[model samples]
Target chain A: MDKVILAKDVSLSYDSNQTIIKQATFSIESGSFVFVTGASGSGKSTLLKSLYGAIKPKQGSLIVGGVELNNVSKSKLNFLRRHLGIVFQDYKLIKEWTIEKNITMPLLINGYEKEVTLNQAESLLKHVRLKHQAGKYPMELSGGEQQRVAMARALSHNPILILADEPTGNLDEYSSQLIWNLLEGANTQLKTTVIVVTHHIPSTLNVDYKHYHIEYGEISEIN
Target chain B: MKSIKNHLSLIVALISILFSIQVFIVVERSIDAYKENLAKNYSVVVVSEKRIANSEFLSIDGLINRVEELSPDNIINRLNTGMDQKNINLLKLTLPKFYKLYLTKFPTPKEITTLRKNLFSNPSISKIEDFSNNHDITYKLLVLFKGVILVFAIVVSIVTMLLILKELRIWQFKHSERMSIMGLFGAPTWLRSAVLFRLSIVDAIISSILIYLIFMYISTNRFVLQQFDNINIKVVIFDTLNDFFLLLGVSLVLSILLATMIVLGHKEEV
Candidate 1:
């Protein structure tokens, strides 16, 4: 199997005395669905940040998409992150842009022309059932609608890896089921790697994915 | 590419408008000053000879000079009811053999600054040295005023460009809805920002045209020309226009530079 992510003794800390995730090691295989769960401050978000190259490991080496985390150049980080879709807890949508334009934001950044960008944005919006909200601004949309738009933008370029941080943390039951189904679709149909960080573990666990628990600053496979 | 093109057009238009408005201000101000200087200082002086007997002094021949009689006459005066040279002899013929010196009060002090500008030394000298402090005051004020307007125009453009650039950044950031687009498509950050900044440059150009129209309307009024006769408003105006154009040129180049920076500086982290 292709190794999409590998970490060996990856320790991260904001200050000298307190280490967030200390001497922790784990590897996530390519094309696999994984759910990471822990208490409120168990460094789940930090781990996701490290994978997307947001937070650098303080000590030890780690790799994502075959790029080492230590001394990773910004340009290289950008290149690596293009393949990893990160869904923030807050949705992180630009308030000024319309929903359709937001979905194709990645494509536009990568120099795609308008017609093609629009088509891709439209296709993704259709997948998320928000084709009608293309011209509307983020602030005009509901909390769940913003997250769905964000997810469409993340998947617009067909990223090989998906990193979702509490995608349904603030959603209603209807919206939560909608987001989960979208993630499941991407994982099974496209063979895309999905890693979701959430506090609540769904009872059903609909998709076939490994469960990892973070406790006392160490990661261990639970199921 | 289309976005880049749009931005370039915008920057060009703004600089052109700003430069033209400043040029118009210079022209209007100069004309007003010239007219006033001519009106207030146009006077004739009659003088009695220094060493004449009372009888000789009284005669028109004994009087050294009368300035109004010698000034250049134009076609407007030729058409007037008063004929040239006839007005002169009529006054002379009626004069008594004894000359009575008719002098305007406080002569040199009033137009002394104008005299210096014309480089006229010994202009009907009564007493040479003493001069009013106010004679030089207008000159100082006009110079300072011109200096200030020029600097203000430049500073305003620079600051406006900065603010416009910031707005463009935020606009582009929102326009890039596909947060993954930055990474996935291998697109450089400058492209989106270039498009948005270009729009602001266009707005600057539009605002400049509006300012020019405002100046054009104000220029038609014959404003305080006589009040500022001692100073050359033209010199100040032309100097200012030159500076204004130069500054506009600099602003265009700087805005383009700033747009480029915005393009390159946009974030990659989504």
Candidate 2:
């Protein structure tokens, strides 16, 4: 399989004095379901941030979808980001916008026509089982529903890869299961590369997935 | 109610600033009109040994315009209590020749002095009354009035601008999260700031229209008209199309400039 994300001896840190990810190297294959699991403050989120260009790696090369993220220009980074979907733990939906509009955000950013974006949002709302809640604002939705809306937004533009950081961390078990199924569906049916950063992965997942564990600022894949 | 609360300070600031500007403009125009009216009714009286020809007075620089030869017949008539026709005619001939010289516009005190100098330079002229003291006092008062209005307008504008910028910064802080999220999703700077720009433009239009209606009503007010009539001066309080476009431009530019500052501040924070 072709690699969609490749990090070679990448080092990341918020402050120059304390390194988070120290010379860690990894690669994620395209069209694969991958989970990055680690303890709290073990640099799991930092690695994800580097992949999205939110934070540049201090050393070595990190490429996402064939674009090097180290010292990347803002415009080029935004261009690369358009092709990727990101799901935040807090949902991060625009509070002033309705669920439908929230889901259409990525499409709008990608310059999709109004009719096309509206239709896409409608379809995604149905897919997420929030068609009834489409007109409601983010604050009006429950945590579970808002997460689902964020998931729909992540999948709206049919991104090449979806990077989710603890998407189900705050959801109930039922919502968690639903979100996992959706992520699984995106990986299996849509063949999108899915990389999720979480502290725990459910053992009951009934699909093939690669697991990478981070310990002491080092990452290694486990069976 | 919430919308009003959110924008009240901004609207008030805009209105106050714009009102000051309009008052400044109208007062300036009114003063100019008053000066012109005074110029029409004011003139210099010159006494000469021989009757001065209107053409001779016109020959002096800045002294040309309307010159009238005054007849000494009025003084002679007042003195003719019981005089005969021959003595009355003799009294009129003995009176000095007086002429009034009108200028095209109000002359400054220095210019008045120059005119007096030019008049006195003629050997035939004996006395010139240019009302230097009155002209000096009036000119000084006019300058002082305009200066006060200008200073007031400038102070109000600067205060209003600072208030506007501070308010915009608050709005930026309020919307920062949403803007950051949009940025993460690859939205361009313009797209992320669309809401800010829209809010500013809408407020600008609203304020501009409000000022227009206010000035329009004041322009036709009886009291305002009475004041101008008292001075025999006609001043256009406001020109609808011209003033509207000017206010709109000012409001729009100010809002946009303040908004741009806030937007650029956000970029620096990131």
Candidate 3:
């Protein structure tokens, strides 16, 4: 399988004095479900950010979806990001927009036709079981429902890669399970590479997955 | 309610700017019309030692529109006290030539001086009465008024533009979260800030319409017409089609440009 992400001795830092991820080397294969686990401040979020070109690798190469991310231009970063879906812990939905409109955001950004985007949004709203609340704003939705909306949005564009940073960190057990099921479904059905950053992997997750743990600024795969 | 307040701020700023521009245009047009009226009636009295040809007057300055000889018949007739025809004819022959020089436009004080100098360059020309004392005061007052209006317009425009920028920045701050959310989803800059642009553009249109209605009413008001009539000057207060379109264009451009600046200066949160 082709590698969706490749990092060779990649070092990341917000400033020069402190390095977060130190000389990390890894490659994620296409269509693989991967979990990155680390304690607080272990640079898990920072590493996840690097995958989407939000945080550039301070040293060495980092490639995502066949595009080199080191020293990438803003337009090139934006282009790369368009093909990637990202779910945040806080569920970064536009509060003013309706949940249905939020689901259509990715499609709209991809220049999908309005009718097609709306139809896709409708189907996704049903899939997320929020069809009854389509017109409701994000603020009106519960935390779990909002995350589900965020999940529906991430999967809406059929992106090549999906990055989730503690997607269910604050959700209840049922909501967390629902988010996991959605992630797994996308992985098996769509053949999308999934990289998730979390402190713990749920024991109930049934999919065959790879695990990478971070400690003392070092990232290593666990068999 | 908050959104309406935001819209109101931008609309108010745009109205001030457009009002200043319209006032400037009206003042300029009024001054031009007044100058035209004055030019028709104003003339320079030139006394010459001998008959000066019309061609010679034209050669003095390009501003000289026409020259008409002031026939000495009236004064000579008033002086005729039972004089014989020969003596009267001799008196008329010896009289110095008086010519009224009309200019194409109202002469500024500097232009009046230049005309005086040019006329005096001819030794045969003896005296020039340009009525500078009154002309200078009127011209100076008009110039002062124009200068004051221009400065006022510029100051108002600058201050209002700054306020517009500030209001837009405040709007951006309110929408920044939404914009950054869209940005994280790979929305283009223009698409992410589409709301700001749309809001500003709508306000611009509203302001333009308000200014148009206000000016339209003032232009047709009996009091305004009577004031112009009292001053014996005809001024075009507004050109409905041309001025409306111009104000609309200015408001749109300014709002768009300011909104763009805010967007470009925004710091993406993600």
Candidate 4:
């Protein structure tokens, strides 16, 4: 398999005064489901942010989808981001827009035709089992339903990679299970590289996967 | 309700600016018309050694339009009752030639001085009466009125523009979150700011229409028309097509420019 994300001696930080991730080196294969488990303040989220160009890696080379993120220009960074999807811990759906419109956001940004985007959004709504709530606002939906909508939106453009930050951290068991199943399906069926950062990984994922544990500001890949 | 509150400052600014501009135009037109009316009735009295013709008066620096020789018949007729016709005729000839010089328009104080110098430069002319005291006071008052209106218009425009800019910044801040979310999704700057642009354009159109109604009502009001009639000057109150297009153009351009400034500011911060 080809490598989708390559980080060599990557050190991430919010400001120059304090470093979070120190000289971390790792590579994740394309079409692989990878979980990054860490204690609180272990810099897992910072590392995930670097992949999406939200945070520039300090003194390292971080590449995603064939684009180097460190010191990249804004336009180039946006271009790279268009090929990637991200699911935040808090869903982050626009409060004013309807669920269907939320899912169509990435497609719209990609300049897809209106009719084509609408159809894709409808199909995705059905996939996420929220077709009944398509016309409802994000605030009108339950927490679980909103997260599912976010997940559907993340996959709407069929991006090459998906970075999810604690997608199920605030969800119930049923929602957590559904989110994991969706992430697993994206990796196996859609062949999209999935990188998830979470405090705990469910033991019931009956599929081949990789786990990397972060402790003491260092990442070590484990079985 | 919320949308209206958001655009309150913008609407106020646009209305004030439009009002000032319209008033400025109308007042300037009115003053020119009034001056023209006054010009028709005012003239300078001159005593010349020889009779001055209308053409000669027009030729000398073109300061005056026409010259009329004043008839000595009335004064001579009254004196003839006390003296003989021969003595009266002799007195009329001996009397220095009296002429009235009509001006083209009401002249400014400086222009009046120029006209006096030009008239005095003529060797045939001896004395000229321009009613300097009255002319001086009228001219000064008109100039002061015009200056006040101009200053008022300028101040209103500048202050209103700043208010409009500040209102636009507030709208930008209010919509920043939605814009940022769209930006993270790889939306271009124009697409993300579509809402703000739409808001500004709509507000511009609304304020322009409101200003139009206001000026139109004032244009046809009894008091305003009466004032023009009192001065015996026929001035155009409004030109619908020209003024409408001008106001609309100004409104659209101002709104778009302010919105663009806000958008650029947001981009730089990002």
lDDT for each residue of candidate 3 in A19-60, tens digit (9 for 90 to 100): 999999999999999999999999999999889887888998
Q: How much DockQ does model 4 earn?
A: 0.50
- CAPRI grade, predicted model 2: medium
Clashing pairs in 3: none
Q: List iRMS for all predictions.
A: 4.5, 1.6, 1.1, 2.0
At residue B190, what lDDT does model 1 achieve? 47
Candidate lDDT values, in order = 0.65, 0.87, 0.91, 0.86
Candidate 3 residue-wise lDDT, B1-270, digit = tens: 646776898899899999999999999988888888889889999999999999999999999999999999999999999999999999988999999999999998888988999999999899999998988888898899999999999999899978977887787787888888888878888898888899889998999999989998999999999988887898878788999999999999998988888887888884
Q: Write the per-residue lDDT of candidate 2 for residues B1-270, one digit (tens) a residue.
A: 545765666677778778888998998998899888878888998999887777778887464578988888778777779999988877777788999889888888878878888888898899988887888898899989989989998998898778877787777786677788888888888988888788788888899999999999999999999999998899888889888898889888887886687678785222
Name the candidate, 2 or 4, with the larger TM-score value.
2
Clashing pairs in 2: none
Residue A41 in candidate 2, Cα distance off native in Å: 1.3
B110-224 per-residue lDDT for model 1 (tens digits): 3544433332232332322222354345445545666777676667667665665665566445544433344433344445354446555554445444444544454443563
lDDT of 4 by residue, A1-223 (tens): 8999999999988888988999999999998889999999998888888888878888889988888988788778878878888998888898878899999999988989999899999998888888889999999998989999999999999999999999999898988888888888888889998999999888878668789999988999998
Give DockQ per model, in order: 0.22, 0.66, 0.64, 0.50
For all predicted structures, in order, the TM-scores are 0.66, 0.94, 0.89, 0.89
Candidate 3: CAPRI quality band = medium
Estimate, for each residue in A1-223, the C-alpha lDDT of model 1 and write its tens digit: 9888899899987667988888877888888999999999998888888788777899989998999987898678778866777788988776656888778777766567999999998888887888888899989999999999888877877888999999999998877877888888899888899999998877655778888988888898996
Candidates ranked, most accurate by lDDT first: 3, 2, 4, 1
